[model samples]
Target: MTAGERTGEKKDQCQGTGDINFKDRIASSPCVFTIGVAGDSGSGKTTFTQSIRDIFGEDLVTTITLDDYHLYDREERKVRQITPLHPEANRLDQLEHDLVELKEGHTIEKPVYNHATGRFDPPIRFSPGKILILEGLHTLFTPTLREHLDFTLFVEPDPEVKIEWKIRRDINKRGYTREQVMAELGPREEDYQRFIAPQQQYADVVVRVRFSKYGRERGTQDKVYQVSLSQNKITQSIEDVDLSIDLFSLLSLSDRNFLIEFSHEQRNTERSGELIFDGELSARMVERLEQSIEDQTQVRPISVFHNRGHVTATEVVQLILAWRIIHQRVFLERCHHLDQIQG
Candidate 1:
């Protein structure tokens, strides 16, 4: 299995999960829905999770960043000469146990990795919620933990873009210098190849962020993070179809898979551009979805998410994740129904 590839096996096909009947599991504990998200450093893991935290509202969703499960604090990692990417550097078994417990609607005192102090802060309480986003580098990498996740997401960005994000974030936010950022990246590279990238094969949804190569690519320094999406064939609704209509005009790809361009880049000479979700999409769509979510969930979002009246990749991806989590019963039923029809 590799990045951008689905495991190609159904949950029923996997061993040790007990049974393939998610409905029974849902019935047993309907309150908790967990999504396991994995991506390399600076690949928009936190940004995407933040978007979800906002859309679902903090009260309804809980995010457990697996970085908190690091076996060694930052200083310890440095002293041991180990990067955070290695399996040896993390408490994988404990992470798996915590996720299993969360799925069963249990609370946990999850560790807090303090980047500023290079140590573990006092653990924070994680009460179970309707939705849980487990976001980090090795999130979907562990098989046992993967089983407990209802949705699995993987994000991989263009190499240059990823490096730029990592460098900027480490220096500005995580208290590191440019030289230190560069130094640690080399050490982490091997672990990334072995642990991080391989998890993508298990991802139910894969989002690739890159410079628009075949189509529009222009973006300012801050907002250039365009996204490409692929997924296991999903059970989409009328709302999903309408959402697709909203993403691209003169679209090249299906609604389920499209590229979001951050700037106003026009189509090429071929007239057959790659599926582009340029920033110039309609505003009504966001409003429509916002209203739909409010209607369904009985809680309106704080405000419609947009940048200068243009819809963003970050915002739309948040909607897609919301669609998956909020109507998970619909998604799961439709999938099984489709399977029965096909079988």
Candidate 2:
């Protein structure tokens, strides 16, 4: 019997008091929504989660990197000559245990993997919250891990775009030479296709940041693309924002548009909110929202576009809160439906 049924509270039980109700009981517990971002090494998975963290705020959400679950450090793996992309490179069983603890709303001491030092750092204890954003190379690869997630996201950029990002990120952040990065890329390509790419089929959403021909083509400019699969198979192109200054420049804008549309379509059928901001009230609200977001996220909202573009850190937090509200309503609706059926 599940925990709810074992509590012996008929009203609290999700399933009716019957012999065949055990399955229903397991299905109706308070759900933890998990979003997994899986992609190539430099396909912006970490960057994507940072944006999500900013929007959700640390109070309501927690993020865990799958890198922390690595079984061996870089030096050890190199000594063994085992590629990090392989399944054996990680402690999959421990990861499964961590997920179970999170599902139960219990705290866990998460291991810290330091890429620069090539080892595991001190264990950081954290309690799972309403939303959990997990990102890394093999986040979606394991079937057991995949089943626990409420939503799965795949970040796939064009190969050329990813290579450029990998080079820049490795050189600047990981202290890898351009030649070393290039050499590792070829060896990892097969592993990525074998293990990572296959997970995309199970994804509820696939986010692609692609370069499109628009105004003056200075270089490769990325436009955010979001595909939602829960309510409807809708594909949207988020407005093109400049990616020169920072990687997260366009993430909030894309997330805002997606959440607004998704919530409107699911909850209120009224199309009252404007998709694009233009007028004075909208502009003022944007300014106030930006200020609020900055107060929460501790990051300055950099200007990332031309033509009267203004997005603040506070607005991003508001967008995430709005998404949480919508998600909670959906959860409650499901609970009500289950209660009625049990009755």
Candidate 3:
């Protein structure tokens, strides 16, 4: 299917009453829940955020596309020999300013970047609400910007895999030719390494989607691999393998069964293990890692999310469970022993 068609299908599947409960929870939270999903183009950032919007409804959730903060138009960027993926290519200061405003509970006019024409579109006015999902290439890169968010996420699929997805997406949805995509990809790669990849260090969650082993063994190229990273002292390799296994195993189940189980259990569950069988290990490891890192650095770690767009309501519940596990673990780890003792 074409990219737009694929997106539409996912959207259709995502519509249900289950999201109402999720939205109600966000509504009751004291502070707005801000999530940033950063990754290369076509890494499913937009799709993921859209699913969240579908859950919360556009009225309760406002999404700010970091692509809108580009410092130059595509043609201008090319003329200046500037790689669009480079940090210099974006208006980092403006993004920081806007995020700060949002954190302070104010609304701001946001910029719009048009991929079709490769330029900034008209500025759009947005009001801050219960949850804001900020997404794009460099959403989590800057320290100032990262500080304003409640959750920071990085989505890095394998290079070859992402590129192929990009080719298919742009050609089918955006009406680009193969040669056009190839031209864009060449310069973008340099920018990605220098500007984009470094942001992964700041992510509370890193999701790496790889092709399934069965698919690989059968020479199928359509498999996806996802790995999540948090500020825990644990190494990336360990987290990647564990998160990948947990997510992939979850994805393997039929969506119908996943939803039925999630809806029946979410409201009553608190412990991480109650939500998913294998999530407990991932949660404990993350807690230990966060404790080690904070003890050494004296700075609290950020929370990140790997948003896979629209699965069954059960899948959404599982995703939220994983997030809460990571968030609670890190939060507890950051507190001083004195505070715990006093409590």
Model 3, span 112-223: residue lDDT tens: 8898888778897877887777888888777787777766667777787688779989998877899989988877888888889878766654555444332432212322
TM-score, cand. 1 vs. native: 0.74
Candidate 1 vs candidate 3: the lDDT winner is: 1
Please list all clashing residue pairs in model 1, or write none if there are none. Answer: 259-277
Q: Model 2 segments beyond 4 Å from truth?
A: 1-31, 47-52, 215-343
| Every model's TM-score | 0.74, 0.62, 0.62
lDDT head-to-head 2 vs 3, winner? 3
Against the true structure, whose TM-score is highest?
1
Ten-residue region with minimum lDDT total, candidate 3: 259-268
In candidate 1, what are the lDDT values of residues 181-269, reduced to their tens digit? 99887778788888788786677666667664433334343364456555544433324323534535345433322344332222221
The deviation in Å at residue 218 for candidate 2 is 4.8
| Among all candidates shown, the one with the greatest lDDT | 1
Q: Cα RMSD to native, each candidate?
A: 8.4, 11.8, 14.0
How accurate locally, in lDDT, is each candidate? 0.64, 0.54, 0.55
Which scores greater on TM-score, model 1 or model 3? 1
